[model samples]
Target: MNLYKPTDERIWTGREAGQNLYVYQKVEQIDLELQNIPVSGDKTFVLMGYECDEGVRRNKGRTGSKEGPQTARRQLAKLPHHLNENTAIFDAGNVVCVGDDMEKAQSVLAEKVTQILNYKGLPLLLGGGHDIAYGHYNGIKKFVDNDQKIGIVNLDAHFDLRSNEDGNNSGTPFYQIATENSNGSLDFPYLCLGIRNDANDKILFERAREWNVKYIESELFHKQNTSYVINKINEFCKEVDFVYLTIDLDGFSSAFAPGVSAASPMGFSVDIALVALDTIISTNKLISADVAELNPTYDRDDQTAKLVASLLHFIIHKVSLL
Candidate 1:
């Protein structure tokens, strides 16, 4: 099977032509097949798309999120470039999932992510489903030493620890990771923010406790609990040498992000989400991140795509400073 496909360079064109002014104009295109990928003197970010929704399909959810990367790329292209000249951003194409082979697709994604990390590049992955977490996490895990502590910070409504006895679907990635850790791997310190109590059941909560997953409920994401949330995040960051951040679009209110596999009517807003993101990024331990479950099929006027792009913009701008 072909593990990946190169991104179409034409998507990086901007409406207004300015020297290094917008993302489209400033972004560089690179083929991952190449032996040598040129890195910048400063921080380098690589965008890799995982084009598959088989996991969501198996999980009995809506499925057109396979096109998320393409839609997000189009939105990201027109955004203004806020990074310094030395900060390089490269589009590393995508890891395409063929047929219903979620395992193969995820393995390929892990290899690609490991490649970027080996090149000293921070991966900003575009997901086909939240199952991207399994592959994304393993990629970082493969790159870092076994002894080095790594933590997972997930922004989502679900614990994603469902049993994969039937099969590994979108809801079983974290459980899979936890299972792997139980087999004598490194410590799995997971912090989940913006968890909606209604989305997860008692069994899931039990699983979370069994795995010792640290999570903050969606109700605690308001101004009154801002300091408390930040303090929790800080404490989590302090326990790990590295962090892998994953954002599920369903974690946000349907008004802000309607195009997702699972819609959370009582989800948190983007403002408070940004606050949590800022706290995590400030730790300077984030190695890579991904945004998942963006199904454009249910989007209203491209609202969710714009939100994802805007978040990407903010992340790039902030990471550029580091």
Candidate 2:
């Protein structure tokens, strides 16, 4: 159960040995059981916890007067403890505290994720920000064989493909991924879902179109049923051998998830979002997944964190069934 040990000397004194909250085994027992159940090709789930407070500090101007960054850390802290009992916590402990250094943060994340994939396990990442996706994709790219294709399914309000306007902030993950081609080609097929129209930048949209990324706008999901969205996702998944799923909390309606950098008023309802996620997991080719951008300070009584926890549970349960 003692999966996480605070590396920071300053916080090490406060660390309580056998404290279940700071440990992984006690929190994610259920998930581990699922891993034990096994799949044909050595399937495993490794949860990589990268707590990046650095991105927050760098983007303080965009954060405005909100305590978005601190809130993100607090909400993420609850995850290791909450999932400990479920047997789903991956590794001896996959939590890595990257104390605000962007380059080091990316390196640490990339190394851990590469290790996970090397072991043939799915990397379920819990993020510091959307910026983390850049490193996440990079790690996955390193391990994927030349014959295999990696696909990304991003569920977010924004496209996140911005072209480094403010030097690689939260809004430019996909741009980083798309621009970086390893071993002679774009590493994956990046699909974005639940995007809010107003949240997208014109340049980002144009870039997505040019790259042939498939996306479903929020308005389209509202107009159609879950089956329609699922069908679209399935179609997209058909083109790739492995898939990486990224869920940004901002994709949900403000009522359900207000703990995010940019809250979207007319976003997808919780029920619809779950339905979409359920459909995606059913594909059985999810290589790695992450849920990011949860800022607890803007949340209404922990509603957003609770909702995210429940969705995580659902995703784990569904994957276990496969």
Candidate 3:
């Protein structure tokens, strides 16, 4: 398992003798190798943990997200199953960062993600940090042709396009990606949702424009005008063949998602957030997805992890509907 550690604690326990649907033990935890998952069928949700946060530490953000994968697994396992017998789930375990070599960890994650997609399993990546997006994107690139159009839709507060001159930190994945595009390496049709103007600076905005990045401001996600946001997503959906969806917990208001690397004070609400996600998911063009920045250390009573699980639950449920 190169950089991967087998998923061991996906199990859930409760007090007293009781029948429970919220317990993770209710679901099966199989030790899945890349060869075991089905390549074509009803589709299974393959859970892979990207367990490294060196990027966040480099980005000067909170560093506890390295533990995000297992924390999220605890909550996700308890989510009530909404799909039928036709659909199943598998845990491929965590890609542990044995050292501070973040680049190596990301490359390893990209390889694992490629294996999962090759098997026709929908990779539901649990993150170490939002930097997970870089490797996550690379994995999707493996299954896609260079001539094919792939849209990257990031649900986050920051552009994450910060200059990588400082090296590959959590804030610089997209910038490194766009720079990679300078060589005409591959197509990166990117659209960032929930970007807060206050969180980014003039240089970042300038870089975004230079990269031709499409975005919707965080303020627009308010009550009066969320439909336009949906319209923006729908329009972005129309442009590409497949979309790589990344959800950053910080994209939501710190009130709802306080357990992230960098919490946003004016982030979107859970209600509208779900709406935008459903709009994209319903389109059925999702290639793969990841939920990043779930730092359980900062979370209030596990609310953020629960929210991440809810999104996962809803996403799997929606896929089953399709």
The TM-scores, one per candidate, come to: 0.97, 0.77, 0.93
Candidate 1, residue 234: Cα displacement in angstroms equals 0.3
Q: What residue pairs are clashing in model 1? A: none
Candidate 1 per-residue lDDT over residues 63-157, each given as its tens digit: 99999999999999988886778899899999998999989999999999999999999999998999999999899999999889889999999
Error of 3 at 235 (Å): 1.2
Cα RMSD for candidates in order: 1.4, 6.5, 2.4
* Tens-digit lDDT track of model 2 for 1-322: 2223322212112235565654322323222312342232423465555565355456552232123322332443345433323344343233433444565666667766776677666677665677778778888878888688888898888888777756766777787777776346544488888877688778778877878888988887753577778888899889889888888877888888877766877888877777777777888778788777767656789777667666665676577667
Q: Is candidate 2 or 3 superior in TM-score?
A: 3
Better of 1 and 3 by TM-score: 1
Writing each residue's lDDT as its tens digit, candidate 3 over 170-256 gives: 999888777776666423588998888888999988878876788988878765787798888889889999999999999999999
The residue pairs in collision within model 3 are none
Better of 2 and 3 by lDDT: 3
lDDT score, candidate 2, position 37: 24
| Model 2 lDDT at residue 318 | 71
Model 2 TM-score is: 0.77
Backbone Cα, N, C clashes tallied per candidate: 0, 20, 0
lDDT of 2: 0.65
